[model samples]
Target: MKIKEAILGFMREQAYKPMDMQELSKIFDINKEEYKTFKKAIKSMEKEGVIVRNRNDKFGLPERMGLVSGKLQVHSRGYGFLIPDEEERQDVFIPSSFMNGAMNGDKVIAKVLKEDVKGKKCEGEIIRIIDRANKTILGVYEDSKNFGFVVAEDKRIQYDIFIPRQKKGDAKTGDMVIVEITQWPEKKRNPEGEIVDILGKKGEKGIDILAIIKKFALPEEFPDKVEKFAANIEEEISKGEYKRRVDLRDVRMVTIDGEDAKDLDDAVSIERLPNGKYKLGVHIADVTHYVRENNPLDKEALKRATSVYLIDRVIPMLPRKLSNGICSLNPKVDRLTLSCIMTIDGSGKVVDHEIVESVIKTSERMTYTDVTKILRDNDEELIKKYDYLVDDFKAMEELFEILNHKRLQRGAIDFNFEESKIILDELGKPVDIKPYERAVANRIIEEFMLVANETVAEHMFWTKTPFVYRIHEEPNEEKLHHFREFIYNLGYVMKWSNEVHPRALQDILEKVKGKKEETVVSTLLLRSMMQAKYAPQCVGHFGLAARYYCHFTSPIRRYPDLQIHRIIKEFINGGLTEERIKNLTSIVEYSSRQSSEMERIAQEAEREVDDLKKAEYMSERIGEEYEGIISSVTSFGMFVELPNTIEGLVHISDLNGDYFIYDERHLALIGERTKMMYRLGDSVKIKVTKVDIDNREIYFRLTEEDHEDEELEIHDDIKESLKSGIYEEKVMAIETGYHDEVE
Candidate 1:
């Protein structure tokens, strides 16, 4: 048995008796020579929360003392929660007073003050900080007379960093800076830090996004050696290399992407089989071919893990020399690819598939707009423009529908939420905002990629290879139960059992289709699902409803895909030697963890940039009224989301009617005296009241003008109906459920 387990067993057997170091040594048969080793083991156990030392210098099991170890997630309001590492455990709420200098993202050991029982929240107090999540913070520097401070851009930090004048470096007032903590906070004091970098002035062009990138510690530029190495790589495929790979240069394939996309990493080709089945080929750019493992370029790509797509720019995983040039599957250029060619039956079942290294030449570059016009709108102009590939496009669309139908039948949950597209001018100022529509063309590509990823992953799995798989575990029971209650209160019934499936949530979403509450419902459901991440273990993806899945496409943009490509090549060349397998076991494990972490950082940075741009866009429309829906309700106020996806808070202070109390059960703000309620999904007219650019926050006020105008319009419609002698007939129709149909 492990030393910690033995210690715990011994303590439990003693029935609440605490043992000192000397006593433990004797009980464990330790001599003087082993005393130091025993003491070290005990100390490690204490730090890990498996055991704890009392004031009397005696050790005991933490479970008996009601202690837990978890990572701390601090809120902007100064309070935090201890999320346990154990998946089954509930989070423990830690009030600010009980924090004891614990910062956000710290791994800490807490003593449970109140145990969670029968739906009650668990409460705890931090007793020890095991590790600090970060040593530096990104914030805006402020100049004082002798000493300055940095106001953290990350609201969860809660405390401004104190920078002594001598430690301020070259940072000026209002400059976005990175601060390295020199000394942690003590009783009622701020943490002392020194400026490490001065990003730029706050309002400068590109500075906002730069600040987010710094905050997430995203690598902005490639190292000199890496760039030089990538530049020296052979741009053209050699004759010898062409002989090694399968030649698919004559295949009629097209790269489908956004109009402005520069990195064309994936292309698709489809044809009808002799047996009336469909042959679909997904060709992904063979980035691993040029960027070998352990090289300078590969190291940088591994560090990035995934490309970050910000509002105005992209921080690519690979440099432009490769990502946009040789590795990009641009039309009329010969490019190497790792292709997944599959033959699908009429029922969308993959009857056979082949994963091969191949050389292909893309025939054309098709944009989502043109494809949508051809397939969805049936525009004759676009159809004729791409006349040569008309039959191929139709075949792809047919296969896409069949695959989509099969996925839906197996309980794949599709959250069709609209994403915001913010347009910026040359000055880097927001010019417009709208929903980025996903047309049928986009879905077709997505479906094809999904199948390809799944096929490659399953193949590697059955081969008993060490590889990274995208895993999304099932949702926590407690969170799901809360979601069930909220949906039930909204008059939607989702069948709940001991285990919840994606289909149950899908059914609820289908019921809410076309309702005013659709977006909010889908958003909440998404929140209830676990985040998908890269892992060495094959934990099935709950969202995709796939038993095996890996990111095998877009090697130029994602490290996991590139890593798998190398593994696939190794498998094809020969078999995995014992030595290679041993090495890959460690490499794949570390890559999976690092890629997941970097991917999260990239996503957060992207969100921060998008939020900043959105706030900037809304700043110009101050005081303008817009129709929106109540997206969320909290103790402070409710957040309203406009049709264009700009969300702003409507503070409770601006309610202007009565003292409102938060109704957590119903997700609303209830007026105490008037019994008025503003609930989630309710349509509300709001005027932009305030915009804090530095904080990237927008505020709104509930307006009565739009509501009054809506009421007047309804009254006029009623009056016109009465004058036309249809009022009685309309009332009769409402009694017959015709009003429901109109709604």
Candidate 2:
């Protein structure tokens, strides 16, 4: 073993004590000839923060001394949290005063000062810095007579990059620029940097998104090698290859997606079987077949992980030639696919299934709007135009309802939050922000994909093969307890015995569906749940209430789907050899982690762009008045969301009548002397005061306020949910679907 691993392994012992260099050298039997090399290794580790040397001339791991090593995630208000590198460790909170010059996204060693008493995280202070994530800052250039500064777009980075006159390059005031840090920040001093690249003037067309792209460090273009390799791949299927694959060209499958969607990854085909079961076929484009393992195209796809769908643009994981051409299941064209054909019964149970490499010719490309109009509105024109597909659309809707009911019966938690879709003009300026509505047509596609993922995941899991699974573990007990208390104050009860189940949460969501407090309660409940991630193990998905689930539908867009496609093909062709199994075990382990991290970055970038565009939209209407609902109550302000799903903050200082104090337990703010309480779901009126496009923040001034609670009427579901727990006896005594088993 390397000296670093040996050192850590030795220090991990429960009985081992801190020892001096001489003592460690003796324990590892280090001879005099090799002592210099050993000493250098130890010093290097100490500098990198893997190990620490104490003032007492002793060496040990930092955790042994109550020091947590993790990445520091800072807040806009200067406070931060240390998300530990080790598993099962709670995040350590660091107050602003103890930041010790650590900026956002810095890797550091923090000393735990206090364990949390009534909260979910612990308190700590940064004691040492290991690595800095922001080697370059992307922001707007602020000019000065001699030296300039770059004000970062990320508010969490409180410090501005100081630039010397000579290093300003051609960047001018208000121009978005990338500054390479020349010096790190010290006590009460900002980091110094030099302007490297000037993007364009702030507020210029496309400059906003370009700056965001740099901030998130998203890969903008595929390497030429990857592009060349993708271009060189023949789009046509070889005759020899088609002979070995299942021929499903006459299956009457169709690709259903948005009108603007270019890369259609999955197609669905359904038929009534003679055995009184529904045969559902989910055919995903065979991306892995063309992008071979360890090749240039495959490497780039793995690095990007998932396609990033932004409001105005899409940062695809694969090149357009592959993702939108050969690998896309376009209508009336032959495409290779990894098909999961399932035999589902009336109860939405998959009784039989078959997964194979298949060649299919999709009959039509159906858009969500057209399908919804035909099935839901009974649009005579659309129905008549697609007369032959009316029966198929009705069948899809029927099967979707049955499958959705089965999922709900199994206690799946469906969060009904309104997702905002920002509409941009021809010049990339936000025209409006509207909630994206999901109709029966959308649900049909979703249900089909969900069932296919479960089927593939379960089949591979039972075979004991190595594959990437999408798993959502249960929430933390402390967070759940806190959530239970908050809901109890809101006149709702979480029914669970021994542990919390998704049913207990879903019951609450169903009760508050259209109520005024729906958004607040739903947001809180979703926050209390753990975030799902890609894993090598099938720990079950809590949100879907699914025992087995994997992302197997979008290989053209998601790397994990492509990864499992390769594994499933291998397992189906023949059993995995011992050597292949070993190789795949390592591959999946690394692939899952990288894919998860990239997915997170992609999500954050997308949200940032949304916020930026929203701010721009609000900037155009700074003085307009609008009615809104209080969505969140923080210490410094209250967030009011307009009907269009745009949220703006009402700073506490802007409250006209009285000083408001935050009520932590009730999630409200009370006017101290006036006795006026502003809590979540309260109706209010506000006028836009200001907008900071760079920070993506909107400031609103309250014009009118409503003291009465809007959630006055209670639903019957809430009443039924109030008396849900019948597990007075024990675990088995509970007659709730929370404990129901999956097929």
Q: Name the best candidate (by TM-score).
A: 2
Choose the strongest candidate by lDDT.
Answer: 2
Listed in order, each prediction's TM-score against the native is: 0.87, 0.91
Give the local distance difference test score of model 1: 0.85
| Residue 336 in candidate 1, Cα distance off native in Å | 1.5
lDDT of 1 at 540: 85
Off by over 4 Å in 1: 1-67, 706-743
Across 39-149, the per-residue lDDT of candidate 2 in tens digits comes to 999988877777877679898888888888888888776777887877688778777889988998888999899986774347888988889989888988999898999
Model 1 per-residue lDDT tens digits across residues 1-743:
76777777788884658889998888899998888888899988876656778779987865666778877888766777887866577778887889888888888889999886775568889988878876999999999899999999988887889999999988999999999999987558889999999888988888887888888878889999999998899887899889999999999999999999999999999999999999999999999988899999998999889999987788999999998899988899899999999999999999999989999999999999898889888899988888999889889899999999998888889889889888999988999999999999999999999999999999999999899999999986756787888888777888867788888888888899999889888877876777789998998889888999999888999999999999999998888998999899989999998999788778778877888889999899998998999988777788999989999999888887577777665666655555456778888889998999877899999887633442222223334534685433211211222111111
Candidate 2: where is the Cα deviation over 4 Å?
1-8, 19-59, 118-121, 704-743
**In model 2, what are the clashing residue pairs, if there are any?**
none
User: Relative to the unseen true structure, what is the C-alpha lDDT of residue 236 in candidate 1, on a scale of 0 to 100?
Assistant: 73
Q: How accurate is candidate 2 locally (lDDT)?
A: 0.86
